[model samples]
Target: MVKTKVITIASVSGGGKTAVTEELRKRLSTSEALYFDEYDFEGAPDDLVKWVEEGPDYNQWNLEPLKADLESFLEREEPPAYIIIDYPFSYKNDKLKDFIDLSIYIATPLDIAMARRILREHLKKTSIEINDELDYYLKFGRVAYLEMENAIKLNSDFIVAGTLKVIDIVDAILNKIETL
Candidate 1:
């Protein structure tokens, strides 16, 4: 059996990972798509800054389920030909790094990333809730993103600008897959 191709798209918060992942999903109709943020919550304390600074892992999201899901899919007689995961933290997760066939990072400036996060929060969360989350991003998210950005950049096969035309990245991936 041909093994499944796993593509991980990593980026800092609000760095266009979801938007690009959506486009990839539309284009890769046969592939499976995983959204990390869907599992981003685990009922942790409301204070995210303290959570991060006080020895709590910033990436507290449950990923073992996603790993298990991927394993079960791969075990199937007919698994998806490709799997696309919109996730970050390749440098922090050994298992994630091992699972990736292709790694892509959506590069965005920190200022733009934080701005997008604020905009996204305004659309989704209550003002009071958004303030707390924004505080977390400002206090902890920036440091974490910088660390992740540097590590994943060294580990990625392609680093594309978040503002780049999607067709270009999609075409690039498709072309590479054809060669492989």
Candidate 2:
């Protein structure tokens, strides 16, 4: 049986975690990729400002569904050699920490991430809606993003520049994994 290593890629919103995870999966023949956005996690904060003000606890979000799915994937007769996840919490969440063999944090600049997010996710929205969202981001969301990044980066085994090309990022991650 191949020993599967769980590798998690963490980054702020629009920091290319998903892109890197997908590209890495394609390059690694015996790998599976999981995305956090695919699951509706319980205890996820609805108000970022409030959450941060309350002294954010990354473990507050229950990741049981993700954990369950991960276990099921690993139970396959021919389990993957690597399990890559585009997760936000890195090893900060107690429930998922033990399963992580390697934690990677993408250090993306706030401005760059915000630009990417606005261009990618808000194109369909009206101008007023986009403005309102940006206003909110400026007011409260930035704090949450910064806090999350700091926490994850502190615990991560590796840090990749989010400004790198997707292929380059994947190369870096693969190289890091090889060293491990």
lDDT of each: 0.73, 0.90
lDDT of 2 by residue, 121-159 (tens): 887899999999999998878888888676778889999
Where does model 2 exceed 4 Å of error? none
**lDDT: worst 10-residue window of model 2:** 144-153
Name the top lDDT candidate.
Answer: 2
**Model 2 lDDT, residue 154, Cα:** 86
TM-score of each: 0.75, 0.96
Tell me which residue pairs clash in candidate 2.
Answer: none
In model 1, the Cα lDDT at residue 35 comes to 84
Q: After superposition, how far is residue 29 of candidate 1 from its true place, in Å?
A: 4.8
Q: How much lDDT does candidate 2 score?
A: 0.90
